[model samples]
Target: MVFGKVIVSLVSLLLLVGVVFGVVAAVRSRGGSDNKNDSVSSSMKSVTAICQPTEFRDACIKSLGPIAKNASATPKDYMLAAIQTTTEELKKSLEVAAKHNVNRETDPINHDGLEGCKELLKYAVEDLESAISMVSGSQVKDINDRVRELLNWLTAVYAYQSQCLDGLDKPEYKTPIQDGMVNATQLTSNALTLISGFADIFKSLNISVPDLKDLKPSTSRKLLEVNEMGHDNYPIWFPAADRKLLAAQSAGRVRPNAVVAKDGSGQYKTIAAALAAYPKNHKGRFIIYVKVGIYDEYITVTKNQVDVFIYGDGAGKTIITGQKNFAIMKIGTMQTATFAAVGKGFIAKSMTFRNTAGPEGHQAVALRIQSDMSAIFDCSIEGYQDTLYYQTYRQFYRNCVISGTVDFIFGSGTALIQNSLIIVRRPGKDQKFTAITADGKEKSNGINGVVLQNCKIVADRELFPVRFQIETYLGRPWKPLATTVVMQSELADFIRPEGYLQWDKVNRHENTCTYQEFANRGPGARTNRRVRWKNFKVLSPQEAQKYTAGRFLDGHLWLKYTGAPFTLGL
Candidate 1:
């Protein structure tokens, strides 16, 4: 058996080598073309990487599933993920292509090389759908077969991809190619890497859907890696921070005894300026002090700003708000929101973010956070419709009041509101909806949705009298695999005896997503007669760990800086 295994390994290695050589040949063939620039080289690298070992390629693909799961995510994100994954592959492919003088695109010989891979992906997607449909229907046969089929199709695509790379291994596509060729090759490499990552993740989902408990750490690590990548590119927090981008003071806030408001020539004038100055990759403590007035602005701290703390005098006095959303920005512009934070390990204390865009129109968004390991303490997020867009990952809100109407607290992130107030505002005569949360993508590890803890839900008088009239829901799986939970939360009768609502007819998968609760006490929390029991889980101690801050949103790595309530003793 050992000998046989060794032989198989040897054969596989040889096959891989042949694929490499094939890539070289393809590059050389491209070298002969007149457009001897970097684009050809870039294509070569991308193609070669696409054909690399399955395990590594699959790993790359795994990184992108969540990216796609984000409802707010656009095609731009898709292209970006694909292009960022395979730089080395592009370079090697281009080198070989230059040697042979072959241009992959426009060259009839190389035009259809990627076709097989695309076709394979097409089949894989179909197979995936079939598998999901079966699982949803509670059937068990052929699931494993379908998984194998998907993997097989993926393998074949890679094989052909190897051949395409070989086509570039000629003198025309060799070294000494133009700088433009090099750049193109790099870009292609990155894009494919991202695309492949998504494909791999979807493929995994196609396989036996794993439980959340079994996948937390691995998933969290991947999220952290992506967060790091974002930070490296964009320094979205702690602008005035030191070399490490961390706060200078490790143990306390910057303004207990200091009257350092805005220095005439200090590096940063406003909180935004200070945030703008922080380095993305800096670790450790970082602080930003806000003076009393309500600062009306749109704030987005990208993932790069790690370990940051923004403090203010009081939540009511120190305000940070903006009005930007699809409705306000003329739908096509896709503009909306006051603050959007994508940075991990971010903390905001004694501040308020408001969207003055009153309830006349879509009036979307106050703060949209796509961050993990973050928190808001004693802060208020006020807006009309679609107030707080919690994009993805895990976050915590302590003593925070989130007020909005019509799906105000929505998006696909896993969040906790311990000791916070959730005010569901009344819809005006002109308006027609009020939902608490919308879990965009339901796929596991995509959007855990939002969780409110030890919080009160007080609706506006207009909405108070109407029991279930408000089109509200604890959450609707935006994707087919969403999971949301609320434990020990108090809900008012305003929450409609039927606590959850459906996302139209298209996404009513019975068991595709999960919504659960524990020890939730109140008129609205009466789960026996209210809410869908099938979706609402009454957790055991062990299962409850899944809802903890550190376990759910990767808060273990960055939550220390954010003064939010976290689940301990896990």
Candidate 2:
């Protein structure tokens, strides 16, 4: 029996090596192209077929040409080469950004932005590395098998490679930095475009996507499950955090790994100190119980700190506040987050994250969560503009309050907010309108959007009476293919009958965007007077479940264990 198993393993290993060697032959064959034999041209031509579909064909071919050896026709090999090439190119950009960080011209003003670019590029490197791992693995066959998730990560790479320049104060100052980052940007774009147009690439190679329709969510859910793990060993109070977390703590049911209090009563006074002591390679959730206090500091939960659960006294009492603003501080919008979560499986409850930048602050963010499978419950996110930046990956929020003036609850990620309150604050002196969300899902195939489910939208006391004077819109397309769905929610009367405003009145992205409201109630929910955009629709019950927590985010696979109130489907 052992001999037979060993034989099987050896056979599989040989087959895997055979597939990779074929591509390796192409890299080796490039040097021999000058020989002009039919074999050499065919070898090079076969590789060129892969690059033909990319926008930067020459760059695409050249990117793979340098490191590649010999030849193989497997699409995965070419993709691996492309991803690796992108990763290498991004490292160059990171070096350039680091040099710019200390440059005298960038000394005071552009230094922070340059530093931000370095950080964003580092994130891009991680995304590229993950891409390389995804395709290089033995389990993945065609990129098409995991294309949905691949697009999400690759799309993020494209976004991050350039967002650093977007935050620079001077338009002309960006040209040099943008030029330096263009190669990685173009390569990232090629990888994303290649995956997006994989079917076309396959057709060019005279083949069809294997078992395309047979692909199931269960299989993809399993893939998501691999990157993250959680235990259902939460105290009884966790499931109903707002109602029972405090009581459970008092009852000695909740056991936390660490305690942070402002009065120095606990083991740590600062949340940062608690996070600094995060155990390496620790299994299961590391719970941190924060006592009631108004802790004023900028908090960043870095990527290495995974599965850290922090529950505070309450949103009203235990507040994490910052006064960072873009216009005032010159820190980029991406850097202005009062609280940022870049880790995986981060959970925060009963806390208020507030940015006091006000409307004039222009893009100040209260909470920016890029954590995969992160959940925020019973919290309040307050800011004047750009309050909640759900940057990427799948996220869940429930029973929270989010208030802002412009593009507040916005992000380019797959997220669901259930039973939450959205307060529209009065705009700054220069601002004439208030937009609630700016959905940044750029690709049509990308699994990203902000879905507000069973929520309430209301105007704050200062803005309620004057709400009619200021055009309050549900959302505007932040990207060409942006998407947002407000399902089974209550939209107060102040929201305009037109529902949504155009991102650009002249260009009007509504024709290309997806803005939907399904079974939403209240006076503003009536869609009779709504803008008849090309993709806007009132979805039927039959089509609603696809956007629900169970299907949209595959929440059932993970949410069940979070002890949060969530419906698997409509």
Candidate 3:
């Protein structure tokens, strides 16, 4: 009996040893395969790092570090996350731009649609460049495949328009059904081109790329939908719909509160009238509540108008309109604007500033802000050329709609747009639609930049195809290392896939410009094929969040009194 028991124990021990040896052998085999995969992923990572813009390299590192850990301990997983995040961001930007333009829903030419288109393309190209270079050993792709697809998609969308323009005919519609067919063709072509690019890039990197064509057509459509309306990013400070609730005081122009437009002696018809009466270099916050009316006048809040708050009944109710073109005015490139604000800490709410310069013109800036710690909320700016200018310093716009025909939002300032609307109008018969932002002159100390978040974009003229030329940019590296970020936004099909434009003769595409995006979605947001990665990219989610108003825009100081919700998302 003792010998039999001992034999049973020995057999059990032997069985345990065999199982352990088998497990060790399996682990070793898996380790070898994992090392090979890591090698490829690591190579891809180095390439992507090399392609990233120098100024934004730190942002890229910061963004990718955590994602790498979360992605199965493989560099490929992290790279894929980066690519996906970038594609989503560009899509969001385009969607915001498209929605903003559609809200006005007028002809692209009449509504400054051309300028809007230009700006969209500019930023699109900038983002495409980044997406194109994003690579992964798992996917085995280079930046070229994405870039080619992006270019083809953009070309397909704009090809007919280019043809129409080449034919010297104004944008027009064929039969409604025919127009739909054309749109379908453009979309189909875009998908095919993007798929080809994706496949080619994967082939180059010794990775098996998916045949996007085999995927359901709805796949791309669904992605576009997810991108356009998704609100992953926080809209904590919507300057366009919020009130700047300035502390009330007994100073400046104050009379009987008035029953009607007549306030006894001189109660001031509009806030502009009151501002004109106020003494220069006045201390404290000056409140100017404008009554509801379309005031057709040009305003200049000079440096003397410091620490003043201008409020109105509502932004749409108090409309300011003017008909002026920088070309006709013969102002120099730097000085070509309609309204110039050079004051410090200026605040405005519930106002509509318009420059009614038609497409046959040059720069016509509607509102040029050049102040430090300035905020504009719940406002509507309309113009043909330079519409909302960031002359200098830092400024924030929330819940506002900006419409223009040319480079509408441009300049050198630390500007941020949250939950706002941007419209791009079709340019003149011979021109293009360049819209959104035009940032020049990079600066240290967070002085010169622009960021757009949770916004909608739209374009006029359904069949109107717009080209994103070199001059149009979401934001330029005007001052070397010019920084612009669009994060977790929506983009419309109207956005060209090329993504960004360059300033005429500006050579900062490689070294200084810092353009990045994250978590964007839309038909226009697909980055499987985009521009060269060496020149542009999709930022990691962590890097992209730094541009948020609460995180980067003075830590809620500007939004505190602006009446906007402080909704910092987790």
Which structure among the candidates has the greatest TM-score? 2
Ranking by lDDT: 2, 1, 3
Q: Which residue runs of candidate 3 sit more than 4 Å off their true CA positions?
A: 1-266, 270-272, 333-336, 443-446, 461-479, 505-511, 533-535, 565-570
- Estimate, for each residue in 199-296, the C-alpha lDDT of model 1 and write its tens digit: 24334335233333343222121212223223433223223333233332343424321121453433455667777777655556456777777676
Tens-place lDDT digits, model 3, residues 1-570: 000010111122223323333444465566673675444343334434322432344444444455544534443444344444444444543443344322224443323433334343333334344444433321332112232223222332322222212211133322222332332233223322322333233344364433322222221212111122224222322222122222222123332222112233337764456667767555555656666776766677766777666766677887777766645543333334455666667877778887777666677777878666678888888876678877555578877888876667876666788788877776666555464666654223222467888777666552246433412334444445556777666777666566665555746454656667777766666665555646477877655656766545443434555444443321
* Model 1, residue 446: C-alpha shift (Å): 4.1
TM-score of each: 0.56, 0.81, 0.52
> RMSD of each candidate?
17.2, 7.6, 21.2
Count of steric clashes across candidates, in order: 103, 14, 83
Whose lDDT is greatest here?
2
Q: 2 or 3: which has the higher lDDT?
A: 2
Candidate with better lDDT, 1 vs 2: 2
For 354-456, candidate 2 gives per-residue lDDT tens digits of 9988887888999999888889999999998899998888899999999999999888878899999999999998998899989887655456788999999
Q: Residue 336 of model 3: what lDDT?
A: 40
What is candidate 1's CA lDDT for residue 411? Answer: 60
Segments of candidate 2 deviating more than 4 angstroms? 1-53, 64-69, 72-75, 102-109, 137-147, 197-222, 225-252, 504-508
Candidate 1 vs candidate 3, TM-score winner:
1
